[model samples]
Target chain A: MADFFQSLLGNVTNVTWQMAVMWAIGALLIYLAIKKDMEPSLLLPMGFGAILVNLPVGSEALAPIKTLFDAGIENELFPLLLFIGIGAMCDFGPLLNDPKLMLFGAAAQFGIFFTLSMASVFGFSLRDAASIAVIGAADGPTSIVVAQQLRSGYLGAIMVAAYSYMALVPIVQPPVIRLLTTKKERLIRMPYEQKNVSKTTRILFPIIVTMVVGIIAPGAVALIGFLMFGNLLRECGVLDSLSETAQKVLANLITLFLGLTIAWRMQAAAFLSPQTLLILLLGLIAFVFDTAGGVIFAKAINLFAKKKINPMIGACGISAFPMSSRVVHKMGLKEDPQNFLLMHTVGVNVSGQIASVIAGGLILSFFAGLV
Target chain B: MKKKIFAVLAALLILLTPLCALADNPDAVETCPPMVQSQLEAAEGSITENAEIPEAPEAAEPVSEEEGASETSPAKGDQALSFGESLGYMLKGMAGIFLVTAIIILAVVLLEKIGGKKKDGQA
Candidate 1:
């Protein structure tokens, strides 16, 4: 009886105060995910994974999550798989209808480059700085893929920042948009016009985009190709079952595994660094700058255009997708009850999604040779 | 024609601003010696190509094992960078993204023109 108790509780005796702290942090994340409903899909699993990995187990016991990390994250499978699901779920109809909004999407990626430089100024290496800057993409998967490609030391912090800031887009974007644009600019209304896009156009759009991005920025081919393939699955109509599977079942499963796998990097020593704090701070700055970039770009364009654009539409260009679009829509409504920017914002928002993938590939391309 | 020219010019200006910034900074990429730069590039390529399994926590005696492992991981190192170099990379990267964006915009504009012409022909 004594020997059995000793064997069972021996691992418990090895638990450090830091492990206890990590458990608390994990519990907090779980609480935020469940009670606060903050990015529940990822936060819940990540919280559980953090606790599971940090628990005191005997030296001989196998760490299962580590295996998941190796299989999923280390080889860059999960993010790419998740992109397929994302592409399947995305409807590019709004963007297709209004092709010009793609400019805003491109403009918003200013945050990633700006943040990269800023992170470097803060004393990060080129690789780590670039990875951290990708948090500004307002994209979780892109951040993960870029950071993994760069082999950044702060992967856990970067992932945490990317997802957290995405969830916080509603809160982060509004003040920045308000600060940049006047009440009149925010209230500027562009009439909603629906232009029918041909089925052939829809089919060709993804293929053309994949080819264009692949040729120009070959490094981004994998990221863009997977995404376009998923979109192809959706638009082709014959692959309805496969599209649905990719959208629902595949996305959910991969997200769960991806969340849990990422926790392998969240061990107390890995996560509790001063650099983690800096990363979180820099991530917030990136979000702010991305919003500013879009808003400012819109304001700049408005100067030359005969038709005034609701400058707030620019704020939706970050890769937060429907969330940023929805936030801009709500802001438009608040500025003027009759203002409808939903489709317009969504258009730019989707563009941001594509632009972000392209930006990620571009970063890898430029930095691949430099690093 | 003028509007199209203006739009294209604006896009080019947006794309070129970063490259101009890179050119302004003389010491940015050139400061790093060629051999070290190549090695860094190689290391980066290999790291991305090979997915080495990260160290996991020991089931038992977790604290001591982790403490030792944590000391050796790259995350703990302090990487210092001067502001100029950071700005250089930032400009270069931003230029690359903007250039791609400019090309995409031109493609979309062409598509729109083609689509409009098709509609006119149909009418």
Candidate 2:
């Protein structure tokens, strides 16, 4: 009875205030996921895993989670594999119809570089700064790959910031978009023009993109290759079942494991630092800059173009996918219900996905050697 | 137009492949000079010894190449660049992305033309 009491009660005594704080943070994430419906697929698992790892249990008890981390995230397997599913789900026809929209994707990545400089100024090591700056990609997988490849110490904070900001795209982008654009610009309408894209073109796109990006930024080959490969599987016309499996089953399974495995690093000692707070702040800055960069680029293009483009479409250039696109579309609707910007914003949104991966690649190329 | 674009792409690929290979070649990696390397090793040894001897008087040695290198070394991953260097990276990165995007756009245009022809033939 004494031994039983010690075994049960002793561990309770070992729990520290930091662990208690982490529990609250975990509970808050769970509440946000359940009640607010913000990235529940990832946030829910991450919240539960946070509590699991932070328990006052011995390291031996948490060994399985660590093993999952080592096998999946540490080896860069999960994110790359997840990219295939993401690629399969994407329909690049919108982007293909208007390839100029791709430039907006490139422009939106300005936030990433801007945040890189800012994080360096704030005294983060170059690897950590680069990893942190990638949150501006508004891309979770890109963030994971960059953070893991760079071996940054703040992987947990970076992952949390990346995914949380991605989910908060609706909240983060509108204010920045409004600040950057006028009501006139916001109301400017872009009529969607659908082009009949050929099957051959659709099939060729992923292959060409992989080759081009691979040649330019070899460091990102794994990311772009897996992504484009999945796209190829989707567009090939014969692999419908495989594509469906990748889009649904494979993606969900990996996301589940990736979410839970990420919590291995969310222990109080690693995550409850001043730097984590700074990382969150920096992530917000990156998102804001990305929005501003795209809007400003559109405004700049309007100076030369014959037709005025709705600058709000530019805000969709962040890689938060349908969320960023939807935010811009809803904002357009609010400005003028007749102004339907969904198609235009979706084009820019998909292009942002490609551009974000390239941005991740460029960061890897530039810093892989320096670091 | 198709032939010219293909020729250009082929030429670009041929020109760029060797550069990529060179970049990835680990043998091309530069190392610190032997003298600097020896000094760094010695400095690291002294620092480790100092860490072990908590009671020892703190040394007032000037910051050496070892310390500077530590800030920028691959092993440390804590390289903090000056604002100017970071800006240089920004410019270079943006330029690289735009260049690649332009190339991709060119290729897409070429592919579109080819695909249009195929569709027309099928129709």
Specify the highest-TM-score model's number.
2
For each candidate, give its TM-score against the true structure: 0.84, 0.87
Stretches off by above 4 angstroms in model 2 are A1-4, B1-62, B65-76
Output the worst ten-in-a-row residue range by lDDT, candidate 1 chain A: A57-66
Whole-model lDDT for model 1 versus the true structure?
0.79
TM-score, model 1 to reference: 0.84
Tens digits of per-residue lDDT for model 2 on A1-371?
A: 99999977877889999999999989988998999999999999999999999999889999999999999999999999999999999989988998778888888989999999899899998799999999999988999999989989999999889889889998999998889889999889888888888888899999999998998888789999999999999999999999999999999999999999999999999999999999999999999999999999999989977789999888888999889999999999999999999888998999899989998998888677655
Clash number for model 1? 7
DockQ of each: 0.23, 0.31
Clashes (backbone N, CA, C under 3 Å), per candidate, total: 7, 0
Q: How large is the interface RMSD of each prediction?
A: 5.5, 4.5
Candidate 2, residue A127: lDDT: 92
Q: B10-77, model 1: which lDDT tens digit per residue? A: 76866454342333232322455788446533643332121111111122245546677653334311
What is the lDDT of every predicted structure here?
A: 0.79, 0.83
